[model samples]
Target: MNLQDLQWGLMMMVVGMGTVFALLALLMVVLMGIGRLDRKRPHLPPPPAHEAAPAEATPTVHIVADGLDEDQVAAITVAVMTHAEHRRRLAAPETRAHAPGSQLFASRWLAVGRGRESSPFPRERR
Candidate 1:
């Protein structure tokens, strides 16, 4: 492309980006002003001074295993705990120990393979 055309493209890009930035700034300013105004005059009416607020009840869970023996209950608990542990292990595999004398990294090649393996991002197969 000609220099004049390239210059025009750059100018247009700058103008477009500047407009977006300015609009975002203006929106932030407007929101801040609204927040200040809201604090000055809150919409919610103040609670009545004469009436006492009702007490909140805390909910409780009651498990009823009508005919199950203690042994059966223990067995079920063990099964659940084992399954949970298996799932936890599968979700997060243990990282291997770093090589001797290279505490921060795992290799002499300067590769961060171990750190990448434990990262939240999924790895793609090479």
Candidate 2:
């Protein structure tokens, strides 16, 4: 072949070899990326366990209340119970014992007249 034809053939060969080399390089990079992904390790702490506080020794105390008797205890209990019941009633709306014909129930709405007869409002307690 002539020098021009030989020159063209050489150029073609070089370009073909260059294309093959570029593909090889690209495959090597892809393989390296896959290896790096597989080698990647996720760092995480283990699940927590129930840990209890150590027991402590506190001083034992014995207290004796003076000047208290059965009558005082009964009175105190009754007062406290009554107060608690009052608070319980006040916490919610006060409810009346349902006695429709009772004198106490009848006396309240006498001033307001029969217009309030159908009402179920709680009695105004003292």
Candidate 3:
């Protein structure tokens, strides 16, 4: 390319890069301003203690298994209880409901297909 063409190319590159950087900087400032505005809003006090619901007692579970011994059954029960407790503690009050079963099944199937058993090449017909 000629010197004029090279100069034009360089000018275009600089202008394009500068525009992107300027937009990013502008976005950062706008986000910070929004955060500040949110922080400045008045805070509401939580409801008094008496209005809160009373804690419920844990329910008993009955399991019937033919082959398992007492120790094995106890271990399974403990594992289940620990898992339930962990889920209760970690779950968020405002979290969305679980996704549909079809979506979950499709995702799991895709995951299994992508696992170690997957082959890069297609199988030939017999």
> What are the RMSDs of all candidates, in order?
20.4, 17.6, 21.7
lDDT of 2 by residue, 20-121 (tens): 999999999999999998995977888786665556545544432566666677788899889889876766334445544554656645847664666757
TM-score of each: 0.32, 0.34, 0.32
Point out where model 1 deviates above 4 Å: 40-126
| Alpha carbon lDDT of each predicted model | 0.75, 0.75, 0.75
Error of 1 at 17 (Å): 0.5
lDDT by residue for model 1 (1-126), tens: 899999999999999999999999999999999988878654687776775445655554445487676677889999988987887676533323544455674454435665566685877899
Which residue pairs does candidate 3 place in steric collision? none
Which scores better on lDDT, 1 or 3? Answer: 3
- Residue 27 local lDDT, model 1: 100
Show pairs that collide, candidate 2.
none
